[model samples]
Target: MDVLPDRAARAEFPVGERQLIMKKLIINHDRLKEARDAFARFHFPVVGGVADSGSISLVMGDSRTGKTFGAKSYLGGFPQRPGERGMIYPALLVEMPASGGYRAILENLADAMSIAHTLRMNNSVLTNNILRGLEFHEVELLIFDEVQDVCDIKNPRLASDFKRLMRKILNLEKASIVCIGLPETYGLLSSDKQLVGRGGLQYAFLHPYSWDSDEERKSFRLLCDQFDEGMPFLNKSSLGATATAERLHWVSQGIIGLLKNFLFIAGSLAINDGSIHVDTTHLAQAYDWIKPPQTSFNPFRDDWSKKPDTVVTTAPLTTHDPFAKRKRSAHAQ
Candidate 1:
């Protein structure tokens, strides 16, 4: 694909309309599609009375590399439907609990499947309930996001127990398992001789684009082009132009999630200011808005040839705390 396309007419839309457009935009690049395809390869229809061994696939990447987004996008394609027994979910993606353990994993699974269980229920009972749910739902694919937590367990016994549970689930052949997490998650199946020997483990790595090679640079630019085309603005952003692409790459470090956020903010700034298309100034202000005040190196304003010493960092957007905080009485002191 061409790195740059011809500019189009300007969009004349209200600020709210423009913001809504940006919110609904979904850009699917080559790498994201490849990850989705890998998931599809492992998913198979359930054949009655046949015990088909479930395959395990790993999708590993650093944070903000679109690992979870890609997996969830693929899962979204297969909507749940009414089946003879119950609701059949063709694919289900569950997040791994922050406090990782056998029971935590089971609880997360139960929550995803909407299976009710009490604190009094033991692990065996929970596992049985989960298995029954999987069978009744006829879920063909199971995805565990943030799976690195499961691999980070320090206790060997706990890890072994988790692995055994996974094996039990796979032996049932109700669904194929896809573990999505940081790169270290590859170790989840590396030491398991039975899983490895079965030749059912597959690995896919999602990485941010690096400007170290000609091919990599071209690919990154092409991705920029795709994102530019996907934007809702009527006028082309020329994001793939040499100067703009360099600035974008420097700002986002070629992470699609960051790039998407950056562009949305920049585009919003442009639309809010009654501008036809995004400019470097809008991007500069957007950078200031999204990042910490101490982050002074604005890629939009700086020379793209001279990369910054530090990477751009985003500030936390919300102050709301989900966990309970300890409170002290006024008279305690």
Candidate 2:
């Protein structure tokens, strides 16, 4: 088996078509900082665990809440101090396939490590090699994203295999596992007895705030101020203004993803219109594009803005499948 590939040959591969590269910016805001702090607290304790037993943690949240980003950020900052074992990676991050068996999982791990592909190897052999590879790399923390794929009830075998594989991987000294997924991941992971050890903790990534809570409202106002201060608008954003903040809260439902998207869309619109201010009109235009369900409490509407106090409070819309049939119908896709 050609486990050691020619690095020069791989480098000869040509680059693909040019992509419409949008600037990828990381906003170091309060919410993301909180998540990172929580991860740090979770990580240190697991490092002291026994060699034979590893800690399993669930980082569950609604989609687009920056769970993956936070996890990656934490792992990216892992200690790289060189020692007798060479460059030590205190953590490593990998993503799960949408659907596949144990073979697919092995392949993904091999791909991550840039190991030469070897399909002829048996499953047990491949698994052993991967374990050795992780040990060789000295990865103490193993992070998996989109882990809800293993929760498919229709294919119990895949889920069962996932648990078995995780148990094996965690056997490494001071090795800890982190899984990031939507809220359903908590329920799915809890249902599996093999996975439900009471030793681990479950953390929600996106914590939505209530409009009525004074502390929450203050925190949101501060967040709005930070975002507004960072934008390049000449007329200075009033997103932190009490009325504007109220309207913004209604529009975003306090979801960080929606709130950030609204700001970006509105800011872009303002830039395109040769204006420096993001007012109600720009926000309204952005809301039209966001096309949140046409509820009675549409804050973007002119009438609603005039009587912002009348905006009815509703539960945060986290469960709505953005890719569902209704979404396609609404978007004319």
TM-score of each: 0.81, 0.78
Instruction: Spell out the clash pairs found in candidate 1.
Output: none
lDDT (10s digit) by residue, model 2, range 197-229 = 634545555565457677888888877876675
TM-score between candidate 1 and the true structure: 0.81
* Candidate 2 weakest lDDT stretch, 10 residues: 14-23
- Give Cα distance to truth, residue 128, candidate 1, Å: 0.9
**Which runs in model 1 stand beyond 4 Å of their true positions?**
1-10, 44-52, 155-158, 198-200, 289-296, 309-333
TM-score: which candidate is best?
1
Q: Lowest lDDT 10-mer window, candidate 1?
A: 324-333
RMSD of 1: 9.1
Taking the tens digit of each residue's C-alpha lDDT, what string does model 1 give over 1-333? Answer: 112223342255556755766666666676788778767665642333332347677888767788887887887788898888777877889887767577988998888878998999999999999988988888777888877666665666766776777777787877778888777777766778766554357788888787667787788889888777755566677888877886777666677877888889898887777776787789889877765455566667765545445553442211122222322111110
lDDT of 2 at 302: 66
